[model samples]
Target chain A: MHKSLRSTLWILIATLGATAISIIAISRGESINALWFIIAALCVYSIAYRFYAAWIAATVLAVDSTRATPAERFDNGRDFVPTHKWIVFGHHFAAIAGPGPLVGPTLAAQFGYLPGTLWILFGAVLGGCVQDMVTLFLSTRRDAKSLGQMARDELGAIGGTAALIATFSIMIILIAVLGLVVVNAMKHSPWATFTVSATIPIAMLVGIYMRYLRPGQVLEASALGVVLLLMSVVGGRYIDEHDNLRLLFDHEGLTLAWSIMAYGFAAAILPVWLLLAPRDYLSTYMKIGTITLLAVAIILLQPNIKMPAITQFIDGSGPIFGGKLFPFVFITIACGAISGFHSLIASGTTPKLLSNERDICMIGYGGMLLESFVAIMAMIAATVLEPGVYFAINSSAGAVGSNALDAVTKISAWGYPVTVEQMENLAKQMGETTLFARTGGAPSLAVGMASIFGKAFGDGLLAIWYHFAIMFEAIFILTTLDAGTRVGRFMLQDMLGNIWPKMGETSWTPSVILTSSIVVAGWGYFLYIGVIDPNGGVNILWPLFGIANQMLAAIALCVATGILVKSNKLKHAWITAAPLTWLAIITTTAAWQKIASPDIKIGFFSAATDLADKLASGTLPAAKAAIAPQLIFNLQLDAWLTLTFVILLWIIILDMLRVCWRCVTGKPILPLTESAYKPSSLLDDWVRD
Target chain B: MIIKLKTLWKIIRQLSGDDAYEVYLKNFAKHHCNHNNTDCSTPLSKADFFKRWQDEKWQGIKRCC
Candidate 1:
């Protein structure tokens, strides 16, 4: 058989085999036995990676075999990042696939493992992978233009501008929400907080060393940083034991918010060489190593997926966030399964690094598949926990089916029964005051992971194991935050410069600082809100973030569809167009529901109106009344967000129409560039031979 | 906003009556400006102004006005 055919067959066998096994296993009333399901998933994923991904990496990506990458092609000692493809792949994967896959899947698991798992598989294969691959291909063909530019070139100026605006807005919401997750995880855990806090100086030192002492020695510097970070994790436990240090670590939410803002500002202002670069390197290493360990651990442990395939919480009354499975599943598993953010990465960085046209399959399609697996593992981790504990950990006090007794009663009613004593005992084990409404999925996942790892590594290492999990989660999230900030700043400066040209100059220090502050402030405001919300902030913010992120994917897919149509590949365009259409429908409907629905429990706009009614009625008690106005304001804020997404979607649709018209009329599209491959003479020679 | 609208209407009527839109815009500034002093007149003729307004100037005016 031909190489391509063989590779394709291998992929189909692996993927279809896994699908068949999962279906059979679940159908056989063995929903708890996840071992076969996991093995099937891994085997299929491995085959996909080795053959399908390799095909994409070689043929579909179409990386330039002749010229070295920008890092090699134009080695200006800055920004032309040239690293080995595998290493770069690892870096990209680490950067893009962070706590998102973990948190999203865990939260979505409330609907049952099946809904989340199916979404991860179907969404990645049809939607996420296509978005990443096409964006990468387009950007590579256009000298690695950013997603915003691709939108403009293919869609039009309106589309491009809207994409940029949407991207900037999404970044703020994303970082802020992720920050809230961290804050929640560390809220009362002095040891975890202190340990994560110490990573800053360590990142800085590594940055300084890399820049001034051993330039280009990223591997060595990162290795050293990792060792130091691990030591800090160990040391943090000691500090938490000390009374004075514990007090410092136990800073209030307000204090933590301010600290995070300060940190974001400082990190933004600092040179890339100091904090961002080194942290990215370490994060890259930790992200890859830890996820691999988690995957291996899950398979070896063969833990049962105790959670059912579907739950009664499909209504917008889920414990983690109030939303049904249909829209919420797509929203919760945003990045792990499909993320708009990945489009930016595909267009911004990965495209320029393509070594051959074929590399697209691996970098674009395969990278996303890997992220989906991470989401799968996250589902496993969250579901494997005792059902009552899962509910106790995720449910906020406001939505915990009312009060503690009610909460326990309701959770116990759901397949996993538990008593108040059990909840308290588990909380004690995890070293927290209350596990209820601790809605950052990471800590619960950590607790779940620790349960498994503790059994395997022995119970004595539980605390260390717990902290290790914290560090892993922090590294993934923090890298995203820092990198996201930098990208946001650049985008802000770009927009500012368009309005007033001088602000665009990278060297204009004051302007740069001002723009950076504005960008940081945008996301910072959301983070502050999340930190302050009495209910777990993820409930509101994650869905909003998910909407924004998916909207970006919609935009990207529209652009790709346009290009494919222009190339007279309409039949093939559905590969991207179908998913694009689905996302557009999903996002548009969800956004409308969020804005129009009158239920305070679901509709952001309606919630605001309800809050106002409460404030007007004078029914709010004196102590709680002060927060009423803020709640009202947040609801209105959410309405505006929904409106923004609606507008962005229309812009992309208009752009797509324009591109389609141009293609029909044979008008030259903007940003038109030549393909990288010239039907290589070497291939011809090989054919002849 | 009113002035621009009136000017646009006048130009449209004149063009529909005789000259084309572009030609009317070209000749309007030279013949029909309130100042009638060539030096005081802006370089943008009626047609040029309409085009510019449609693309860029109108958005600014609409935003502010």
Candidate 2:
């Protein structure tokens, strides 16, 4: 086909798919098929990748293929080694993806699928991908500087400090919310608890094998690790079947939360090779394989979307979490759409290994497009289950009541009718004692995945598939939990190093222990409170994580825009500035509501005040009265933190505006400091190998 | 036919990280010491090079959310 004709064909396909999707979503009083959502997403991504991404690469970044990259100019066989583009893409994608994309969309399914799906598709292409690519390009030109270093160099000291503080704060909240998810998924479920616990030993065994038995044999070690992991997944079923063994592994949410906290602390203090590295390698492979399998299964099965286009939850009466759809949906679905975390990875590792500057288009922008697709798949998975079941699984006991009958009655009154026996049967089939209030989004997603896989693969394997999905999600979440804690410790040491010079040394024993303890406690306190909260921890922790993450993204975009202005690329400044302005609005509104709204359910301060009023009036029940003070304190603390995030965002935004003003007024702020231009002499194509 | 199958196997091994040391040795010989040898065989032993690479790769802020 001719080139223009090919473009025309693609445009036609995209238009058709979009039209079909909007019609399905908007049509009232009828159920829609999941296949339309998948088709719509795939078509839109194809068009976006081919056209919008191409335009950005050519016009905005002006990628020059002949220019020598830092990886080529400073090829030292260590950090600056030039790598194959696909390998770099894989590594970058693995680093950025976590349980965030999967869980966020699952939770946001409360407003149905239309709003979340649309935001994910538009957000990644316009906001997330642009931030990542521009940041990667800017950092690469400066010899692969990290985000914080770039902020300090391009903006000023204040911007740099705010960026560093945002990174540290986001890391703590990210870990806490992730830990809560794992805790909720494992609570009182012997099958999931046993399977997840088995991964630690499997990783340690693989680590020792790689270190002592067969050094550098990563493939062999990870292969063995994967096989053993599968065996453990199967073995967990038998363990759950055995009455005595099940009793040994079964525990409540609070106990599991404590165990996870201890695990995070120990994993941080221990050597990387022992548990963190090995587990990371295993999970990377599993992550890719599982996501690929899910995409395939969804396409093959084409399950119908049971949830409506819009639900009553859009009004902010959502049982899963509070806040209306406008800003909350964008906040809820961060990772899949435009996660700020990817900016760190883009500026951190991907730029260092870029053999050719052109590969930036693929690694930075394309990698995020794939993550958005994962979020779309998560939406599909959440909506595939009966709406009643999704609500029953995701809503907390406090919202829907504790028992199965009460849950059924409450959910039915809300419009979606489900029977107690039906819930029990589904739980028994999935090999769980009860799935009434799983609360964390993991179990509901697993149920969705299991149904899709079971329908596509075979019958009587729902339990196996369900356990496998749980293990898959748990592996990645645990990987993030341990890795985030370690990063947090390093950042803490760097901060404390200013006061006590000796504390900066990473290898010092007391410094390591002290920093690790502080880092663990920072997130651990939130995880403990979340586990004890009657409404489920995700309702509190997830929004905090989203706000913190978007704040970091705002900082990253500010740095990008500042760099562009300094470099005299004023014409293309809108590429970064537009997203930065929109994110500032969304995050500011969400933070303001969280801090000062009068609604107890949505606002942190209001919730605290309401609880206090109840206690003072002696209207609280005896059981609730005991923990009311703590809950109030937590709410108040969360309100303050939200305010802090908003303040940091404004500080960085103002710093960026200062740089822009200096550029516009010709005040000669500072000259651009890109690395000396070097021409590539290598005759070999990095990709041809 | 057999050669094609063997080539496929080699590519799979390379992608799955089985041939990392060999690739590293080639790159090291070509770029690290300024030899620019086409064959790119390095003086450092395979085990030593692999150990060094692992240590440097695992160091700071490697994962994200």
Candidate 3:
């Protein structure tokens, strides 16, 4: 009774606090303290993790503590070694946390804080966390199957094929959008470009150090890499100050785009240990350290969120991306909320390392909850910037003319007023010539982070803090870019092998170069188009990436729901089914709008038609007319891609439903595929104790 | 003081994957010591094992968004 009382009191306090905080956060207000977002996220995560996640782990999945995991059964010293639960959690978190959580929330803040914050908090607890934990548990039970293989086995051929196509397309768009972000961040900024450029040689140096001097010393090498990386962040300022040095590093968007493509290609085909491995190691350390510092700094600073609780952009006239708040916020902020990408990592990547089935809830659900908090922090970071500055940095010359004065006038007319002098002052303070029309979320987020960090640590070193944040984000984006390119190469090879078997040979140099080029070309085309886009490439690429990501999540949920039905747990399938239903509704809605809406700004097909008509009638503006034909083609291509995503999404969902219906009707369906249980020895030790 | 510091240092090594080879050998010995027979397959060398590990880790969808 005493324990029950304590528990009840705990629930009551958290519930009341969560309700009170959310109400204040959402109610019509301006300049709400950013601290409210932090409190609200914490309250929601703790409650959901404790109750909903625990119930799913205990009742729905029936995770048996005594059941031996695959790691215990197949203790290969390489992949399947049993690990401490906390260590597994950390590794899992590191693998899943990327620029997605950081960049998505930063972009979604264009709609203001309320929508993104609520979505991140509620979406993760109910949708993303459940999806991840259930997928991890089910995959562990099935011998750590890949997402594609699980779909093939449980949901049949159509579902499996859809999953494969979704993953490949997601990779392409994800890499391209990330490349666009990097290009936008580094373009014309010598400090960021130089710091980012320095990372390659720095990583290689550490790789050689680890390989030759102290074999297998990852910690030592990464420490050396981190120290060197920090120095470059400082070194960038020196380069920026020197005119000749600055000219060498500074480049346009198109040049940076090509350079990034070259870097991605090289990283893909080059030996992994040299660049990819060492960079991954070094970046993971920096990711953890920098994210922790940002968290502490946010708490210490208690900065006010300058953006309103809801913006006029909610109706879909925002310069960042063109979409309504309802589904667009959900679509834009998939990673922190219900990212489909986590399902890929959750299934085969970390499941095999678990020693106990019970650890799935913590490692999967808890890890995502932490990522959601990071998303909340990002939203706070972006929102803390003056709304006028946010728009100035995220807008494109296409929306707000090419010059700073014209851009200021256009943005000021939007009710979020700014001046040319204010923009110039900010740029000068941050050690840049101009922050206008930066477009991608990276530069703005860096400005926000630098502001918070400068106030919290030392107000004197704003430029260094700003560059550090940029380097931190660049490291993440570039890491994802190369790793994704390599993975895409393998997938393409795996498919191409069906036509010509020799193309699948990974070690064959000809096959390697051929497949790598194909994958690079796939994203490089999109990246190049994005750079030339006057309205800012982010407006085009980010939504498409978001849709692709959510579609992948939809595929993952379909697989999870199908497995649950096969397991004869169709009644409790709502845990996966609800989120699956939400994703299906959201992605299809967003895709439909993108493809069919008459508004040229919101609809891909409409935009293409408008541009084609303009070109035909000779009414196109001078700058636009030059790029008119290509723009029309790209718009149509994007429309077709959106249509394809929707079609694939429905196919998978319908197949899952069909299998589910067959199960409910007592028809013959695939039997549940859990591995035979082996009682763990750890249970015996507990009994002895 | 030294013991605490040593424990922390070991953890850093483990987390950064620096101690993978040592951990692999220890686990292998624990799994095989009871057999005392040649049927126990020889474990991979440190260099070969690291190579195998990198190939697998870098392949597939290793990282997320």
Candidate 4:
């Protein structure tokens, strides 16, 4: 076909597809099929990746095919050797993706699928992919320097320090909320508990096999690991049936929370090669395989979405988590739309492995596009459940009384009618005793995934499929927990080393254990409080995680925009500045509301005051009054943290603006810190030999 | 079709690090020598190269959420 004709064909298809999506999104009076969402997201992604991404690559970043990347120029056989672009794409995708994209969208489905779905589709095109690509480009030019170094070199010390603090804060909250999700998922469910616990031994076995038995045979070890992992999922079913085994594995939320904390601490102190690395290998393959299966199942099953496009919960009265649709949805769906975390991965390892500068578009923008698709799948999975069931699973016992009957009545009052019998029956079918108050997004997402898998594969295997999905989600979450704790420990050591240099020696046994304990304790406290909170811990921790994640993203954009302005590309600075400005507005509003809103459900201060008032008036029951003081304290602590985040966000934004001012005023601005240009003999089309 | 399948297999192997030693050797041959000299120094053995590669790849903030 002629080039123009091919272009015309793509344009036509994109237009038709987008139009179809808009129609589906707006036609909320009638139920829409899940397949419509799949088609719409896929079409929109194709158009955005092909057209918008191409324009940005050519016009904004001017990604040159001829430019030799750091990998090619540095050419160290270990870290910087040139490799295939697809390999870098896969590696980057695996690193940047985790439970965030999967869980965030599932959580945001509370306001109905429309809000989260639209944001994810358009947000990735305009915000997420742009951040990843621009950061990748900037880091590649600067010899694959980390985000912190780039922030300092470009935006000066204030921005650098702010970015560093934000990264550490985000890591703590990220791990805490993730741990909370795992605890909630496993709480009082023998099958889930057994399956998740089985992964640790399986990972250890794989670790030993790779280390002592086969040594560097990753594929072989991973193959064995995957088989054992599947067996564990099956073994969980048997354990669930065995009276003694069920008693051993089944535990309430608090006990499970402590167990997770202990596991994280142990995982952090252990050698990476023994536990973390092997689990990572198995999880990567699992992640890829599961995501693939989900995409295929969504297409094949094409189930109708039971939830409406717009729900009344958009008015800040959502039972899942509170906040109006504006900032809450954006923050809740961070990883799918635009995660600040990806900027870290973009600058950390992906830039170091880029074989050619041109591959940045595919590896950066394209990788995020794929992750966003995963988020879309999660959204589909969540919305496919009846709205009554979704709310019953996600809402806490505190919100809708403790009994299943109370949950049904409350949910039905909101217009989506469900019954206790229906809930019990579904739970039985899925091989669980109860699914009420799963609270975290993981179990509901697993329910969603299992539905698709069971419907597509075999109906009789719903229980197995559900456990399998739970295992997949839990594996990734645990991977993040272990890795996040290690990273947080290192960051703490770096800070503590300022006071005591000996503490920073990563190899020192005392230093390792001390820092690991402190880091685990920091997040473990939040996890403990969350586990004990009457209104599920997700409500308190997830928003904090979202806000902190977005704050880091805002800092990343600041660094990117600063680099652009310093290079005299002032006109092109809007590419990064646009997202930065929106993030600044949204994060500030979310933080302010979280701290000051009068609604007890939404605001930390108000909740604290309300609890105290209730206690003083002697209106609360003894059980509630006993926990009121601690609840008030937790709320007050959250308010202070929100204020701190707000302050950190402004500090970096003001620093970035100051740099922009200098550039505009013709004052001597900081010089660009990119490496000196060197000509290369490598062809742009060079492939791995 | 068989040829295409073989090519696909090779590509997958190359990307997934199944062929890491082979790729590293090729990279070494391509870039090791300075001043246009060929084979100026022998590259590390495959076992040594693989160990170093694995270590470098896993260090320092490799996972994200």
Report the lDDT of model 3 for residue A533.
92
Better of 1 and 3 by TM-score: 3
Candidate 4 lDDT by residue in tens digits, A1-689: 99999999898878878776887678866778887787788788888888888888898878777777788787765677677788889899999999999999999998988989999988888889999999999999999999998998888889889999999999999999999998988988999999899899989998888667776677788889999999999999999999898999989888898899999999998988788988998899999999999988988888888888889999999988999998899989899999999989999688777878878899989999999999999999998999999999999999898988989999999999899998998899889989999988999999999989999998899999999999999998999999899988888888889999999888799999999999999899899889888899898899999999999889889998888887778888888899889999999999999999999889999999999999999999898888888888999999999999999999999999999899889888768888877765567346644
Q: Candidate 3 lDDT, tens digit per residue, A186-258?
A: 9999999999999999999998887767777778889899999999999999999997999999999999999
* lDDT per residue as tens, model 2, A427-493: 9999998898898899999999999999999868999999999999999999999989998998999
Error at A161, model 3, angstroms: 1.3
Please give the range of 10 consecutive residues that has the lowest summed lDDT in model 4 chain A.
Answer: A680-689
TM-score of B chain for each model? 0.27, 0.54, 0.71, 0.73
lDDT of 3 at B2: 100
TM-score of each: 0.84, 0.97, 0.97, 0.97
Cα lDDT, model 2, residue A184: 85
TM-score of 2: 0.97
Clashing pairs in 3: A340-A553
Best by DockQ: 3
Model 1, C-alpha of A561: deviation from truth (Å): 0.8
lDDT winner between candidates 1 and 4: 4
Ranking by DockQ: 3, 2, 4, 1
Off by over 4 Å in 4: A684-689, B29-50
**For model 2 chain A, the run of ten residues with the poorest summed lDDT:** A680-689
